[model samples]
Target: MTDEIKVPDAGTADKAKLTVAILVVIAGVAGYYVLAGRPAWLRWTPVAGSLALAALVLAFSRYGREFRQFVELARVELRKIVWPNRQETGMTTLVVFIFVVVAGIFFWLLDLGLAWATKLITGQGS
Candidate 1:
């Protein structure tokens, strides 16, 4: 039998907290727009404060914990990547450019041949 992982359902409180967190962020954006006539600093303050509080609330939820773990895993995997150097990148780019040029020339010749054949058959053009 294959092992399957089942995610547990979030508790009621966790769901409520997540909802509140989302609402807090939405309220922050709305407040920012609503305070457009006020000073820039004052307009931004609600957005900044509400976002911080939302983040705090989300951090206490199970989904947030899972998200943090996923981010950590992604960071670890990113470190294992072997990025190509400048010379290799340049050579690859040059090869692709050459291939594209050759392909374009080949297609152009094919199109000219087809047009000549069609004109000869239909007697339409010199």
Candidate 2:
């Protein structure tokens, strides 16, 4: 029989990430206290440590492959996104303005017609 080792489960990965997050937060707070007004290198210690912790958490997850795949899919979808060009956007705006103007004219005409009809029926117009 062939033998193959199963990778860590999703729960394990999630737990690892949680633990890493807690450690990062603690480390960041400690670093701030140790070097509150220190130089760039001292300040960067915690910042870089947090980033490294995030990397380790992600790396330790069982769903790491799936997560990476989803990120890749998102990137591909972004590439396929079709942004409207300036000319097309301008044309659409112009069309909307024209439609609004035309609609206003139509409503105004309708209102005037109704008013005239009412006036005629009541003998208000000579």
Candidate 3:
């Protein structure tokens, strides 16, 4: 039997994603603290420095190569997408408008029926 080939870059790719996720969370928390009244001198400088460090690490890691490959894959996938032209976009917009109007009419009718039924049941017409 012939040997099976396997994609070997997934581990490095996962590591890169994990690193990015950690960096994002750290940055978010730092921004939140700064917004919640932390001293400016204590906030922005350190956050900026940490972000720079993260960028440097990301650029130097083996995972960075994997990340580049992932980006290339995404680029290819985006190229395969079919976007709507102006006419198709306008038609879709019109269809959405029609659906919204129909839904509004349906809901209005339901509300009126409920109001009438309640009035009849309680002998209090408004």
Best by lDDT: 1
Clashing pairs counted in every model: 0, 0, 0
How would you order the candidates by TM-score, starting with the best?
1, 3, 2
lDDT tens readout by residue for model 1, 33-126: 9998999999999999999999999898998898899999999999999999999999999999999999999999999999999999999986
- Candidate 3 TM-score over all chains jointly: 0.63
- For every model shown, what is its TM-score relative to the native structure? 0.67, 0.49, 0.63
The lDDT for every candidate, in the order shown, is 0.95, 0.82, 0.78
Model 1 bad stretches (over 4 Å): 28-53, 117-123
The residue ranges of model 3 lying beyond 4 angstroms of the native Cα positions read 1-42
Error of 1 at 7 (Å): 1.0
lDDT of 2 by residue, 22-101 (tens): 78867876786788779978887887888677666766565556678889999999999999999999999999999999
Between candidates 1 and 3, which one is better according to TM-score? 1
